[model samples]
Target: MVIKKVSIIGLGALGILFGHQLAKKMPRADLRIIADQNRIQRYQQNGVFCNGECCDFNYVTPEEPCEPADLLIMAVKFNGLKDAIQSVQKHVGENTIILSLLNGITSEEIIGEIYGMDKILYSVAQGMDAVKVGNQLTYDHMGMICFGESETGLISERVNVVTEFFEQMEVPYKVDSDMLTRLWGKFMLNVGVNQTVAVFESNYGEVQQEGPARSKMISAMKEVISLSEKAGVQLTEEDLDYWLGVLGTLSPDGKPSMAQDVEAKRISEVELFSGTVVKLGKRFGVPTPINQELYHRIKLIENRYTMIG
Candidate 1:
């Protein structure tokens, strides 16, 4: 399929970043966003901010689900997948490809439950720190997006074409054969940075600079990795090298998504991030004490925040 129009279902940090870049590069490609009606109305009536870099654009919510797009990029919370997909699936064309930029290993399966395995792609983004603040969406990391065939192996040409298009747009991207390995690598990152940093109420930089906090981050990642191996997802030495290297290079000021969620007092995908490992520890008959403890502590903190809200 010769991609033309691309619709992003979420207008949060990553969504706005991609849309801004896509609009700039693919000028001909119709870039539509599926946002909350209120946010959409605000942006349509008054331009939305890309984290202080505001843009005046025509954005509209579907009144009653019309047609699907050539490509659909999903960027909602993991728990909100079904609602997010339902909102935009009607606009997804028969040949549409659903690319999930969310955290965790179950995105493809979530979409596959409805769209089938052939239409889904599991993707991971590094160095991307996109989030919503009021009417503005900010992405300080300017990261890269990597995606490939899930289990279906049906969209080689389409994947390549989309990846090339991303590259042309100055989005750092790569395609790998072991997509699951890539996913687990990120899962480790989320377990470490997203959860631990959120618990610290600090950004990536603060955590790294704080001696005790950084130690905690390392412990959390190691535990998550152990949980992954127990679940039969073998992570190699090279994987450790790449991820550890990434840890050293991460933006000092960047905060993990979980931290942001906690600050915002929004329901997080903790269950998918750390909680997944805890559940898997049971499934694989291996105990993940560190992860389990973090999961419990983080849940308590999250609950406290929610109750406060």
Candidate 2:
């Protein structure tokens, strides 16, 4: 089936990047930005800027009845996933393909539990260094999305449809044979880079250099690699090295989403990264000292806000 109508939730960094690309490539009427009434009004007034160019987007409120989208992109934060799922309900048709761009390993499952798993695809968004400050987004690399069926070596019909849509949109994507491993690799990257950066208030440049930040980042990821073995994914040091190469390609001045969240004084996705690793470490009888420390440090950072307020 050809994917024509596309609906996307969450207008953050990645959302703006993809949305802008889609708007440029496809007819404006075919893309829908789903949000509540207040957000729609606020976005219309303030406008969303991608690299200083104001995007002309079609915004639809969740309550407004419309044709079900052929593809639904969930770009909301882990904390906001539940509300986002509810918000996009009206846009989901029986044939709608769902892709959750949220970080960590469990988002697909979380989304699949509500919508049927049949509608969900395992996807990992990697190699992007996009940063959003307020409504403005800046990035040098737009990144590529890797998505496929849960089973390896099976190119399903839905995967091909999404692949064709991405090609038309001029967005880079890869159809992986083993999507689960790719997702876990992404989870490992976030568990390390996002947490360490958030705790130290650093950017990609800091972590890219050989120092405490980079050391702590790799160490935190090592803990996940250990847990992956027991959890059955069994990520190797090679996977970790692959992410390091990707990190080197990012804009040194750019930051991860968690670091951006901390700088903006907003709630970050510590829970999704370190929090998830810590939980899985315990479940799999693995030790996660690096992640435990990172988790504690980030929580302290969050606490300072409450203490000051």
Candidate 3:
């Protein structure tokens, strides 16, 4: 499709990271930040800062009259996906390729149910330490985005076009042949690192250390490995070790999105991570006690913001 016009639905860490990178390459009018009126106003006023540099993006609302984007990126949290889907309705054309940078594994399926599977490209953002606080996002490493066709292994036209676009934008990416395994690997990493850090109110440094926190993190990830086996998309200790290595490269103080959510007193994506694990564990007859506990602990953290003393 050549990807001339691009629209992004979220301004989270990953969103800003890619948006900022694309903005540097593409014309300002070619890349659109799709948001409602309220969010547009807020973004215009507060401005988006990536690594202390302000981003000047073309902001468009759902109701605005414009041509559909060639590429649409959905980076909203799980809780906000519904609204994001609706907000980007005016921006989706027949040939538009959609990529979901959400943490969990179900976002593609959820998006595809409405947008058709043909338009959806499975994607995962890995090895990034970007953390967003307020309107500012800072990252030590710009992670590579892994994406491919829905079924994986075949580089389709859409995949090639997206790859070209990413190349032009100088954004790091990997065209994965086995996208499902990569997605599950990322899910396992989130199930371990995100939930564990959020629960303990610690940073990457704590889990990187050899201690109870690290042990608990590995235990939680082990549950995902078990469930993956039952689901026919198995991840091994090697994958776990690989992710641990990625975690090691991240800045010690960098907190994941879930940990940032807890610190900001915002709702986290526990339902997508450990919640998904626990649900699937039941279906697969895999005991996911670690994820179950992590799920409860994260929920408890969320409840603390609203629960009466």
Please give the CA lDDT of all the candidate structures.
0.75, 0.90, 0.91
Number of clashes recorded per candidate: 7, 0, 0
Question: Once superposed on the true structure, which residue ranges of model 3 sit more than 4 Å away at CA?
Answer: none
Q: What tens-digit string does per-residue lDDT give for candidate 1 at 103-171? A: 888887888788877777678877676666666677666777888875433448878878766766776
lDDT of 1: 0.75
Runs in model 2 deviating more than 4 A are none
Q: Over the stretch 1-309, how does candidate 3's per-residue lDDT look in tens digits?
A: 588999999888988999999999999999999888998899999999999999999998889998999999999889999988898988998998999999888899999999899999999999899989999999999988999986756989889999998988899999998899989999999999999999889999999999988999999999999999988888999999988998899998899999999999988889999989989999989899999999898898899895843
The C-alpha TM-scores of every prediction are 0.90, 0.98, 0.97
Ranking by lDDT: 3, 2, 1
Best by TM-score: 2
Error of 3 at 228 (Å): 0.8
**Which number leads on lDDT?**
3
Q: For residues 1-309, could you state the per-residue lDDT of candidate 2 as single tens digits?
A: 998899999999878989999999888998999988899999999999998999999999889899999999999888999999898899988999999999989889988999899999998888889999999998999899899999888899999999998988899999998988889999999998898888888799999999999999999999988988998888999999998898899998889999998887788888889898889888878888889998898889888886786
